[model samples]
Target: MNNKKIFAFVIFISLVVASILLLGKDMFSPYVSFEYAQAHPDKYVQVIGRLGNNVPANTEGKGYTFTMTGESDEQMAAWTAEAKPANFEHAEELVVIGKFSREKNIFVADKVLTKCPSKYKKENN
Candidate 1:
C-alpha cells in the first residue's frame, strides 16, 4: 500500500539521477596543446594543428604517422591506428583525438579529422 508506493517512487528517482549522470559525460575531449599533452600523458585530449612537411611512409593498409605543428609552433609526432583520411595530404588543419604516449614520445590518436584548405576559400563575386 503506502510502502509499495514509496519504494516505487524511490526507484524512479534513482533511475532518473543515474541516467543524467551517464549522459552528462563529455563526448569530445577538450583541445590541448602539444606541450600540455606531453606533460599529462594519462588524460585523453584533442590536439588541433597543421600538418607538417614530414610524412611517414604508409605501409600496406597500415596506419599513418606524421608530424603536426601546434598553434604555438611546437611540433609533435602523431600516430593514428586507423587509415589516413582521404583529404589528409591537403588538409589545412587537423584535429587529433587521443592521448600522448610517454614511452613512445608520440600522440596515439583514436580519431583524426581534417579540414581541407578549399573549405575556407572565399567565393568570387
Candidate 2:
C-alpha cells in the first residue's frame, strides 16, 4: 500500500477510536440497581425508581428516606434512599446518586432530582 494511503488509514482509525472512547464513557457508565447499589458502598450511581415505600423520616434532621421500584421483575424490589432536608417526598422521579447498604437495604443519596410535572396551558380560553 502507498505510504500516504497507510497514513490516512491510521489517522482514520485513530479518529474512530478516539470518538468511540469518548462516547463509550456514557455507554459503559454504571447505572446500578438498588440492590447492586447497596452492595457497593462509597461509589456514586444513578438509580431509577418510583418515589415511595421505604425511606424513613429524618429524625436526626438530615434527610428523607424513600423506596424505589426496580425496573425488572426479578429485581423489582423496594430500595431505600436518603434525601436531604426532608423535602424529597415531593419528587416526581428519584434519580439518586449515591451508594447502598446491603444489610439495611437502603441508599445514601447525595443528590436527588424531583421531576414535577407541569400543567399545560388551556387553549381556546
Q: Judged by lDDT, which candidate is best?
A: 1
- Candidate lDDT scores, in order, read 0.85, 0.60
Candidate 1: residue 110 lDDT (0-100): 92
TM-score list, all predictions: 0.76, 0.50
Candidate 2 stretches greater than 4 Å from native: 1-30, 53-59, 73-87, 121-125
The predictions' CA RMSDs to the true structure, in order, are: 3.4, 6.5
**Root-mean-square deviation of candidate 1:** 3.4
- Please report the TM-score between candidate 1 and the true structure: 0.76
Scored by lDDT, model 1 comes in at 0.85
Clashing residue pairs in candidate 1 (N, C-alpha, C atoms within 3 angstroms) = none
